[model samples]
Target chain A: MKPILEIQDLSVEVESKKVLHHVNLSIQKGEVHALMGRNGSGKTSLSYTLMGHPKYRVTSGRILLDGEDLAGMSPSDRAKRRLFLAFQNPVAVPGVTIASFLRTSIRSVRGDEVPAKEVRKLIREELAGLGISETFMSRFVNDGLSGGEKKRLETLQLRLLQPKVAILDETDSGLDVDALKAVTSRIESLRSPDRSFLLITHYQRMLEAIRPDVVHILMDGTIVKTGDASLAKEIDEQGFQSIHEASAQL
Target chain B: MSPYSTTTRSTRKNRIESLPIPSRKDENYRFTSLSNFNLQQLNPSIAHPPKTVEPAPEGFQLAACTYPGGLAIALESSSHEGLHLSPFEDAPEAIFQKHRAAFDLPQALDADLFANLSAGRCENELLIHVTEGKKITQPLFLRNFFPSTDQAFYSRTLIILEANAELELAQEFVWDGIESLIQPFACGLTQIVLGPGATLRFSTVQNWNPNTEHFSRTYSVLQEGSQLTLNEVHLGGLKNQTRHLTHFEGRNSQSLHTVTALAQNSQQMDFWIDAVHQGVGSRSDVEVRSIAQDKGQIVFNGKIRIEPTAPQTAAYQKNPCLILSEGAVIRTLPKLEIQTDDVQCAHGASISSVDEDQLYYLASRGIPENTARTMLIEAFKAPGLRGVSNPFTKSWLSKNLALTEEEQ
Candidate 1:
């Protein structure tokens, strides 16, 4: 089956330094793929490059979404095609409240201006599912939010947006057990047959909550190992050193 | 008894002549200049002549009131028993002239030039008086429209809140003339005098047409246990400057000064607020926000003065500016002058561009760059309108002052 997202021989550079070198990976439709790596292993660089971040230059490689190359496409254009990235640390916009921001995002994504009345109803439902009170919907986007609140807000976006290919960039960090449970449950509820997900994390705890169909060990800007869910379990037990060392000898 | 009931032409000429042209070199004019524009282009208007309008706009019955400028425009209802509404000229000359006393508070308190101009030339006046111990449930609405772009008119507005009285006032100024044909100028004074234990909410919306230039002075004095709220939204003009002076004359008086300005496409705006704490145990809070996009320029200067005798005073000020484009400029300065150690005072100012992280976050959510910029700018400036208590006026401002999609 054709993959929904294909990163074929992809390499990315930031500020003239090569951070992702000839990295190649792909996610089939409806599959949750976990990318595990140590710190500075270029996990975030890959996510940003895939979303067409300007600073993350594509030195050499082809990134295709449903067989269409995304090179030179702006982030918004990429998003309109139903691609979404939940940042590791979301930015706080004090004056643009949650309801308004989400309404704007929905309009840009759906190419239709939703009425303010309807937008409020739509957001209230999402806020409830995340255990957030109605007042949260009126707050400036992430303004004065705790770290845990920011993560839940991002997860709420992931569920509300319903992107075709969603990238979760360390959305688990800073989340306590309850928040972690809430975020993973949201991810679980959002999984579907046509949707694909890229879970970028160094922790197996996230995978324990929402198991990935496939796991790839990323080291030094390349996918050094690809295996079934067992590989993630093995990394959890033995750590990434054994995997990277074994991949080096391979 | 009515010495101030009328301003003499010779006196006006002397006042205008007494002051030298203001320049950036002056401390008060640090962010604005009169030398940059041609005073020769100024087109003067006759004494507040009555204007005739065939039909009213916005269902507020505006046309009838905007004639000959904003003078003699009938407020819909002064039927509320304690509310005393009279034309500035028809008010008791003694009281009218009495209120005009110390009209140059800005000049005395802030060393301003515009206050002196309005004091020197004002001919048309309207007074809204709230009688002592009376409460007005209905807010009084005043509208000023300069239908001609080629006008240089002088006008004044005075509001007197008697002791223990309550009042709500909303005033709007709409410039409806062509800039190229007639470059109009309007200099005016708005004074509010609050008696002991009185409260007043003053809301102003200034959207002078881009071709028009507006310069004005505001003087507000508060007595014992009184409270004052000033909410102003300014958007318009080729260039505009507004200076305000608020003095707490009695202990326990409180004042909230809120202002917002939006300028785009070569427009220039200056908002200066100065508050003097002369009464012990008085409090003053000042908040200002401005947005300048596409070569527009914005200036905000907010200062709080605590006199030696004003012990137990609290003064706080915050000014935040958002610049939307490369050429756009914002100069914000929050100052404090504490004469004695018996008071607590603080001031801060910041000018910032859009944050990249926020932009990327919005973009990744499918918002186009231009739309994202508009959303962020609106959010950045929304705090300026937070203190507006009137729903009708607040929503009107939120809708009209909002930049259309293309303007972004």
Candidate 2:
């Protein structure tokens, strides 16, 4: 009955440029909320701000995860609290293998050292679920991986971590049809009564595969419209110009 | 300023017979001023051998032992069959004598009062030989203990490896609690002849006390198809200077040299490394990393020279220094002299503080600023330490790094 994540009057600024202006959003448990916006529409900024990126300053607002204030909490602390963000552009950390990084992340979040064999098993299962090869575990994290491979790796982390709230920013943007289907199926499998997701994307193609309970149209750093799944289809047919006109009339 | 009135000329004729004249303006001694140390004036007292042999420290084991004037020594002792143990004694007519004469012996010698005393007292010299087609499972650990402050110490080691020999040697220099000034000199000459395929890993951990001024000179000659790796970790010193030179004479030889220095307080450290590639298809890599805090000062000059005859050679040198305090000073000069056009040679030197972005990233993860800084330092130094082949040496380096972090 309670909202899984609540952002009240969230405004984010990066280096004197206002990216997100007074954006209010909430997603209830078991609900797939799609945040639709054009390029530079502040959708990714909202996701990063919620995840506590140091570069994104919250000028005024509060972020609540399961009713607990996460306004000033660190990204690692937030991660420990089961908050995960699938970065749109994942940074490559040299000399840190994917296996070791995943093991460290899991141990830091779980507060217990898992055996190497168990860690390898979990990584294998997660990678297999995402259709990633075993060789991916030995490579450096996000190093020399293609865009589609990086996205799948993000999904691999999402599956392995199983965070309470996942903010996946355009994870299906560059994915092929098969990859899109696999990624969508992975997201669909993670849908649970106690879990929530904030999927930020510009394409309605992803929504057709993994249906959303609610769809919101955002323009110029603010959310303009909120409606049901039919709204996504309506926008797919009419485009965002008609929605802008309709919102202006209101 | 008469020609014969110079210090070297007068000393050569009156005090000592035929002292080699060393030019002070040499590039090797450019940054370091030897005038202040005054090595020639302080005549150290001779050291007597210890009454009883002391047990080695923890994490260290003795490989082979030889009594005084013994014919049937270990195979490793054969390399130094004709090496003179003392500089004051008449030089032998062996390969080691020729190698010693090639350098300015008197200037390189540590004749300080304490060094002479320790050299006279420490009679146990080690000779390590790596036979052809032989691989040592454990690292040969040599512990040189300076328990007395009344005498200076001088130790010499001769290491040789035949073709296809692989070995790891770790030497630790420790000076117990002493207030008197001590100068310990260590000179090591290693000849590695690689028959088709051979590998050698050498690591040194110098933990001299604040009162000791340590000087070490190491020269290694690699033959055809050989590989040599050297690692130096300097954790403690008052005034320390080390010179390491590697000459690649045979084709297809390779060398990787890494030096890590962590200095605090008023300690001064200077390191000079020169790698000469004389053989075609040879490769050389040099990396020097240092961390200076308090008022410590460190100077590192690394040079990689490729001869005209040595075509198709590859050489890379990098020296990076991290200054933790405003008072700390670090001077790094990474030089490359390539005579041949068909060579891949590059050098880089970076002197920087901690990265602010990485700090913020770690802090946002709930790690405190100090803890984050430590993590970043560990990450920066971990690359060089991970390349260590010996697990015990790697662990030892990790322990030293932790100690440095705590001191900071």
Highest lDDT model number: 1
Runs with alpha carbons beyond 4 Å of true place in candidate 2? A112-121, A133-135, A230-250, B1-36, B40-61, B64-126, B131-138, B148-151, B177-198, B210-212, B264-268, B292-299, B320-331, B350-375, B386-408
- Give each prediction's DockQ, rounded to 2 decimals: 0.62, 0.23
- Give each model's whole-structure lDDT: 0.78, 0.68
Q: What tens digits encode model 1's per-residue C-alpha lDDT throughout A36-110?
A: 999999999999998888888998889999888999999999998888898887888888888778777887886
Interface RMSD of each: 3.8, 5.6
Best by TM-score: 1
lDDT of 2 at B84: 19
- Candidate 2, residues B1-408: lDDT per residue as tens digits? 212123322332243322222334544442333455544533433553334444533454454322221111222432333211222222233433433433222333333222222233323334455556777765556655555443345454556566787777666666555566445433232233344467878777788766566666676677788988878788765777777777787888988888888878987788888888999999988888888889888888788899987898998888888898999999887778888889999888889888665554444333456755776676567656635856577766667656232210
TM-score of chain A of 2: 0.95
The alpha-carbon deviation from the true structure for residue A112 of candidate 1, after best TM-score superposition, in angstroms, is 6.4
